[model samples]
Target: MGQFYCLHCDRYFANSTVRDEHFKTKRHKKRMKQMSGPAPHTQLDAELAAGMVGKARAPDCRGTLGAVEGLPFIFLLM
Candidate 1:
């Protein structure tokens, strides 16, 4: 359950150490090269990527876990 996913490559790691290792690997870096850049997506973009309906919603300020996919990698709400 503890893992970090590579957004660019859609890969996952069990821990930060492994994640860091993956980041350093040639294959991982190569995959990263395929990305447009490190620009963060806007809330609207993130919502669309998460497959939500019109009017992107922000996660509850109460810090509750809501609908999500590939959790730990992408949080759709919160």
Candidate 2:
């Protein structure tokens, strides 16, 4: 006898037969539908979009600030 785990429902079944039956349940179907959709944005994402968060600096190449062969030497140092 082995246990079967359902990730969506967070429940365990005695066997694959029971687990397969659980997958056909309305609760499991609803959970699947909810998980299939795109995730909602969080407050941090909203702040970043609104420019409230500090903006990231753009890569500076232009053969300046120790750029070797068009690639930043700082990256190689890392």
Using all chains and alpha carbons, the TM-scores for the candidates as numbered come to 0.41, 0.52
The list of candidate 2 runs beyond 4 A from truth reads 42-53, 57-78
Clashing pairs in 2: none
True lDDT of residue 70, candidate 2: 53
- lDDT values of the candidates? 0.61, 0.65
Task: Looking at model 1, report the run of 10 residues with the lowest lDDT sum.
Answer: 61-70
The clash number for model 1 is 0
Top candidate (TM-score): 2
Per-residue lDDT over 44-67 for candidate 1, one digit per residue giving the tens place of the 0 to 100 score: 455555667343354431232233
58: Cα error in model 2, Å: 9.5
Give candidate 2's error at residue 64 in angstroms: 29
Leading candidate by lDDT? 2
